[model samples]
Target chain A: MIHANDEPAVPMGLPLPNGKLAMWLFLVTEIMFFTALIGSYLIYRNGQPTASQPWPTPHDVHLAEWIGAVNTFVLICSSLTVVLALWSLHVGNSKRAVQYIGVTLALGCVFLVIKAYEYQQKFAHGILPGRVFEKLDSPHGYKYMRHVQEQLEHIEKHGGVNDKAKKACAELLADIRAGKLQPKDVNERVRGTKSIKETNPGKEFITTKDSTYVDLPERSRPKDAPMVEGILEMDTHAHLSYSIPFGNMWASCYFAMTGFHALHVFGGLVVFAIMLVMAWRGRFGPQNAQMVEVTGLYWHFVDIVWIFLFPLLYLV
Target chain B: MSEQHHDHSHGDHSHSHGDHSHGEHSHSHGGDAHGHADDAAAHFRSYIAIFIALCVFTAISFVFNELVRGGIISPMTSATVIMIVAIIKAGCVAYIFMHLKADWGKVYCIMIPVVIMCVMMIIVFLPDGVLGWR
Candidate 1:
C-alpha cells in the first residue's frame, strides 16, 4: 500500500513546526528589546546620586526577590506539567494528556494573578514608574523642621533684612501661599550643601494623586495650613525631580519586552486549550500526537524566557 | 534501496527472510518491555538532574546578587559571575533535558539562530552603553 511520490509523508515525531519556529523568532526579537531596556536601566542606575556616593548603604529591597522567587516556582511547576503532558501523549494516554494540560493552564493563571497582586503592592507603596514621587517623611524631617523654626526666628529678629534673608523669607511666604514648601528647600539654601548630610538614610517617599500632600495622611490637615508641631517634614514633593532623563526610555523597553513575552505565554495557553479540546474528543492517537509535542516546545520556550527575565529584572 | 521489513514477533507473522536485510532489530519480549520501562525512568531522572542543576545555579545567582547589593562586590563582578552561571545552566538544560547530546548537529541548527540573536542584542546594546558613559 505505497503512496504516490507527490504525497507528503507524515513524520513520526514532531520535528519542529513552522509556528514553533516563528514563535522562537519572535522571542529572539524580545531578547533584543529587553537588552536595550535593562542596559538602559544599568546606565541610569550608575548615574543615580547613590551610585557615586560610595554605593549607597544597601537597604532591604527584598520584596522583589520574594515575589520573583514565587513567580519562578510557579513557572517551574508549570514546566513540569507541560513535560508530563507531552509524555502522556507519547504513551498513548490522551486523557492524562488533557489532565496535565489543564493543570498547566491553571498554574499559568495562578502566576499571572500573583504578578498582578505584586504590581498592586508596588502601587500602594507609591513606587510606581512615573514622574510624581512624594518624598516620604524621614528623620531629615527634623532638620527641615529646625530650618523652618530658625527662619521664623530670623524673620522675627532682624525683620529679615539681609538679601539672602529676604530671599529666604520671600520663598517661605511663597511656599505658605502655594502650600508646597519643604524643609530641605530652606536648609540646603540657608545652611549650604555641605552642612546637610549627603545621604538621608531614612528618606521615604509616597506617591498618591497629584493633589495629595506628602504629609496629608500623617498630618490629617490641609496642606496650606501651617502645622503647630514645629517639626513637620517640609513638602518638597513638588520640587523633587523624579525625572531621570533616560529612565522612561529604559522603562518603556522593560515593559515592552516583558509584555511581549507574556503575550506569547498567553498564546501558548490558547493553543494548548485548543489541543486539549481535541484530545478530549479522542482525535489525537499515538499515530498522530504531533500537536502535543509542538505545544510542549512552545511552553518550554516561554519558561526559558522567564528564567532569563527573573534575574534581569529583579536580581540585577 | 529495496523495501525491506522485519517481523519482530518471532514465528508469529508469516514473512519472507529477505525482509531481515533492512536492519530492523528485534528483542526478546521481557527484555524489550523492561528496556522501555527503564528508558522512561531514565528520562524522568534526567528531569530531576536538570532541576537540581537549575536550583544550584539559581542559588549562586542569589549569593552573587546579595554580595553586589550589599556593596561587597562590584556590579561588573556580579554581572560576570551571573553570565557564566547562566550560560552553564542554559547549556545543561539544552543539551541534557532537551536531548541535544543525542543529535549534536540537529541541536546546532537551533543553537546557531540563538547565538546570532544574542550577538545582535550585544551589538545593539553596545552603543547605548558606550554613549551613556560619555
Candidate 2:
C-alpha cells in the first residue's frame, strides 16, 4: 500500500479526495453525451405520428414493452449488487465483495442477452433504420404478407396453390376497390385489403387469369412495394406492402440511443468483472479501495441514465 | 495506516469525519471485528431497504405508463409523474449507492454546469414538429 504519510491531503483548493473529483468530472461529461442522444429521442417521440386519423399511415412502433420492463428490473438489481460489493469490500469482507461483484456482472450479461433477443425479433420483422429500413416486411407489413408467404410455401411444396388457395384469392376482392379510397370515418382506417369475413380453413390463395387488379391508392408506399405502370399487380409473391406513419425518423433515433446504451452496459460489465478479480486477490483493501468506489460510481451512473431512459423510450 | 481505517461507514455512511491525519498509525476502526461485523449487517440491511424502494418505484412507473396508454391518466400528467419519480430514483442511487452525499466542491461545479447544458441542449436540439417552431 502507498504510504499515507508521504502524500499531502489536499492537492488543490478543490475539496475532494484523490481521483474523486476527476471521476465526477468525467461522469458529468458523460451526462452531456447521453443528454444529446436522449433529447433527440424525446423530440422524435413527440413529433411522431399516432395511429389515430391515419392519413399517410406511419409505422406505429409496437415493440414488446414487457422486455423493456424486465430489463429495467435487471439493471436496478445490478445497481444494488454493485453497491453491495463496495459495502462488502469496505468492511474488509473481500469474499463477499467478490460475490456481489459477480452478481452485478452476471446481471449485466443477462440484460445484454435480453437486448440481443429483442434485436433479433426486430430483424425478423424487418424493423430497421434509415436507408436500409424496409417497411415492406415491417410487423404490419408481415401481417399483410401472411397469405403471400403461405402461397409461396405451398408452391414450393406441391408446385402451385391449389383449390383452397384459389378460393381464398377469389374472396380477397371484397376488400379491394381499384380507385381512390378514404376511411369511412375519423376512427376508421384501412389496415389491409379486405378478405372475406369468414374463413376458408386450409385453403391456399391462387391467382387466376383475371386476378390482376390495380391497387387502390394507398396512404403511403413502402420502399420495396412494386408497381407496374402505376398499377399494383395481384401476384401474392410480391408487391403488396404495409407502412407506418412517419416510421423512418423514429427508427433512426430509437436504434441509435438504445444501441449506444447497450454498448455502455457491456463495457461496464467487463470493468466489474476485472474489479471482482481484483477484490478476491486482496487488492481492494480500504487504503487503496478508491478504485472499487469509483467504478461503482460509474456503474451507478449507467443505472441512473437508464432510470431516465426507461420511461422515455418505452413508457412515454 | 490511519487512512486504511478511516472508511468507517463505507456502505451505510454518515460522513462524520475524524480529524484526518497524514501521520502513520493515527487511528484504527478495523480493530473491532465483532463491532464491524454488526455494522456490516446494518449496512446490508440499508442496502436491502434501498433496493426494495427502487423496485417499488420502478413498478409504480410501469403502472403509470400503462395508465397513460389506457387513457386513465392524462398523458402530460403521466409524463410529469414519471420524470419526477425517475429523478427521485436517480437521487437515491447517486446518494445512497454511489456515495455522492459524501462528496462536494469540484463535483458541484462540474455537475451544475453540465445540468444547465443538458437543458440547453434539449431546447436547441429538439427535432422538427415538436413545438412547430420549425
Candidate 3:
C-alpha cells in the first residue's frame, strides 16, 4: 500500500469530507423506507380501488386528511428552522443557530403529537378495513327492508301496495304454514322471486309460486318482516356486484409507508435535539456547524417524504 | 480540525483557534468573538423569513389535503399535486436552510448517493405492491 502522503488521493466535489457522504447514504435508506410503502399502495389499490360500497362514497378518509395536512405544515416549518439554524452558523452566530435548531426539534415533536391524535381517531371509528370486510356481504339481511321502503314510497305516490300483490303474498305464506297446498304443489308459485335464506336439511319444504321464497333458518329471519307481497323495486339499486374484500394490499401498504416515514421524522427530531444541546454548548460555532447543517438536511428530507405521503394516503 | 479534536470544557473561555486552515474551513465567530453585530443581527431576519415561508406552505398543504381527503377530490390526483408542492418546499429548505447552495461542490457527491438510495428504496418496496407484502 502506498503511504498516506504518497497516495494520489484527491478531494471529492469541493471536499468537506465524509460527513456529507454519510448523510446521503442515510437519505438513500429513507427513500427505500418510503418506497416500500408507496409500492405496496400501488399494488393494493390496483386490486381494489372501488371496494367501498355505494360506488365511491367518501368515507372517513377525510378525517385523516385534516391531521395529515397539519402535520405536513409542522414538518415544513421545522425544515425551515433547520435551514435558518444552518444559516446562523454560516454568517457566525452559534447561539442563534442553536436556538433555531431547538425550535426545529420542538416542531417535529408537535407534528408527532398531532399524528397520534389522528391515529386515535382512526381506532375509534371502527374504520379498520379488515373489520369492515366482515359486514360487506348482502347488506346484513336488510335488503328486503330497503326494498319494502322503496315500494311503500311508490305506493304512497300512486295509491298503495297493489291489492293483487298483497293477496298473492299472504296466500303464499298461508299455504306454506298450512301445508294445505304444497308450495311446490303449485307450479305457478315458484316463478319470479330470488331466494335469500338457505333451505334447512331436515325442514319440510313449502313450495311457493315464487322460487325465491325459500324459508330462512328461524334465527336468521328478521323480527319485523315487511309484508312480502309485491316486488317493490327501488329507483336506486344496490350494486352488490362488486363488494371487494377489505384489509387487502392497499390498507397494508398505507399503514407501512406512513408508519415508517413517521418513525424517520421521529429519528430526525432526536438528532435535532442533540444538535441543539451541542449548539448551546458553543460546540457548533462557525467551524463545526456542519453537524447542524447535516442534521437539517435530514429534517428537510423527512418533510419532503411526508409531503408525498400525505396526498397519496389521504387524497387517494 | 483542531476545534473538532479538542474537548474544551464549558469553562474554556479563550476561543480555541488552531488547525482551522487544514480543511475547507469555516470560522466560528462566537457571540463574543464577532465584531460585526449588524451582520449577525441580519441573519436573524433571514431566519424569520424561512419560518414564515414554512408556515404558509404547511397551511396550504393542510387545507388542500383536507379537501382531498374529504373526498371532495380523489386521493390519487391530490397526492400527485401535493407531491409537487412538497418537492418545492423541500428544495427551499435544502438549498437555503441546509446551505447546500453555499457549501463545497464536492458535497454533492454525498447528496447524489442519498438520492440514489431513495430510488432504491422505492424499487425495493414496489414488490410489496404487487404481492400484498406488508
Candidate 4:
C-alpha cells in the first residue's frame, strides 16, 4: 500500500501539477487565437494601396496615443499585482494576496473603461466601419450633405439669416437636392471665404439677400476687393465635410483586434474575482499555492498580449 | 532517514488541517526556512524591478511614436523600435512574472510547439497576403 510518506506520483511524465499544466495548455491555445487575429489585421493593412487609399494614422483618426500608453501602464501594474498575489500565497500571507488580487481586478476594470471611452469618441465622430468617408462623392458624402441641408433649414426657421440670405439658402437646398452642387463645391467656397478673411483684415464679408459684399469703406477698398466679394458670393454654409481615407478598413481591423483583447481582459477579471474570493476564504497556502500560480500565469499572458497590442495598434 | 520522516510528518499534518500555515511549515524545516525566505525576498525585489522596466519601455515606445509624428524620424524606424521594445517587454513579463524562468524546462516543452506554429502561420500568410502572391 502507498504510505503517506511516499513521494507524490507524477502524472503523464510531467513534474507540474495537473491544474498548472492544464492552464499552460489553455494559454497556448489563446496565444494562437490572438496570433491569428493580429495576422489578419496585418494582411489587410499591408494589402491596401497607399496612393489611392492611404491608411489613416492614429493621429488622423483622433485616437490619442497617451490613452493607449496609460492603459498599457495600468495592465503592466496589474501584472505585477497578480504575480505579487501569487508570491503572497506562497509565503502564507493570504490577506496580502487577496488585496493584491483586488487591485489587479480594479486595474482591469480601469483599462476597459478607458477603452469604452475611446470607442465612444469614435462613434461620436461617425468613424465606424462601412460609414467612413474619403471623398464628398460617395454615399456618406450625400448623407452629410443632407445633414447640412437640415441644419441650414433649422437656421432659416429660427430667423438666423436675412430674407435675401434665406432665399439664397433655399436655392442652395434646391441645387443640393438636384445634385447640381456637390460638397466639394461648398468646401471650395468656404476655403475661398477663409482666404479672403485672412487677406483683408479689417473687412467683413456680408451675405445679403441678393449678393455677398465686403463691409469696407468706399475709399479703402483694395484692388482685389471686388474679386474677393465675388468669390465669397457662392454658398459656403455646408462646410461640414471631412475625410478619413480607408477608414472603413482601418476601423474594422482596429475594432476586431482591440475588441477581442478587451474581452480577454474581462475574462481575466472574472477569474481574478474568483481567486479573490478563494483567498478571502483562506484557500491558498504552500500546500495548494500552485493554484494561485496557475491563475497568475493566465493574467500574465493577458498582459503580455496587451504589451504586443499596445504597440501594434497605437504606436505603429 | 529520520529527517525525511519528520518532513513527511509536517507535510501530512499541513495537508490534513484546514488552516495550514505555510510560513510555519517553512520555519519548522531548519535551513530551508532561511533559504525560502531569502528566495521570496529576491522574487519580490525582481517583480518591482520588472515593473519599473516595463513602465520605462512603454514611455520609450510612446516617445518614438511622437518623434515619427513630428517628422523627426521615419515611420519605419519608429515601428521597428517600438516592436523590438514590445518584444523585450513581453519577454520580461513572460520570463519573470510568469515564472517561466524558474520552470523553464517544463514550460518550454509546452511552449516550443506553439512558437513554431505561430511562426509557420506568419510565414505562410505574409507572402501570399502581404506580397500579393498566389
Candidate with maximal DockQ: 2
Q: Which parts of model 4 are misplaced by more than 4 Å?
A: A1-11, A134-140, A147-180, A185-241, A279-288, B1-27, B128-134
Q: Write the per-residue lDDT of candidate 3 for residues A107-209, one digit (tens) a residue.
A: 8889888877766654543334453222212342234223333433444445444555444444544554454643222222322212211111111222322
Q: What is the fnat value (0 to 1) for candidate 1?
A: 0.06
- Number of backbone collisions per candidate, in order? 4, 11, 20, 1
DockQ of the candidate models in sequence: 0.12, 0.35, 0.20, 0.33
| Model 2, span A2-92: residue lDDT tens | 7989787654445554465577878888898898888876666565432221212112344655688899899999999888877766666
By lDDT rank, best first, the candidates go: 4, 2, 1, 3
> Could you estimate the TM-score for every candidate?
0.60, 0.69, 0.57, 0.74
TM-score of chain A of 3: 0.59
Candidate 2 C-alpha error for residue B58, in Å: 0.9
Better of 2 and 4 by DockQ: 2
Judged by TM-score, which candidate is best? 4
Per-residue alpha-carbon lDDT of candidate 1 for residues A259-310, written as tens digits (9 for 90 to 100): 6667877888788778767777877544334455456656766777677777
Candidate 3 chain A: worst 10 consecutive residues by lDDT?
A: A234-243
Query: TM-score of the B chain in model 3?
Result: 0.58
Please provide TM-scores computed only on chain A for all of the candidate models, following their numbering. 0.54, 0.64, 0.59, 0.69
Query: Measured by TM-score, how close is model 1 to the native structure?
Result: 0.60
Better of 1 and 4 by TM-score: 4
List per-candidate RMSD values in Å: 13.1, 10.6, 14.5, 10.9
Report the C-alpha lDDT of model 4 over A1-316, residue by residue, as the tens digit.
8787796854454555567678888999999999998888777777653323345667546588899999999999999998898778777787787888899999999999999999988886567888665555656556757765765566556745555556656665667777786664433332233343333222232222211111112212343544322122344332222355567788888888889889989988988888777667867455546666777888889899899888887878
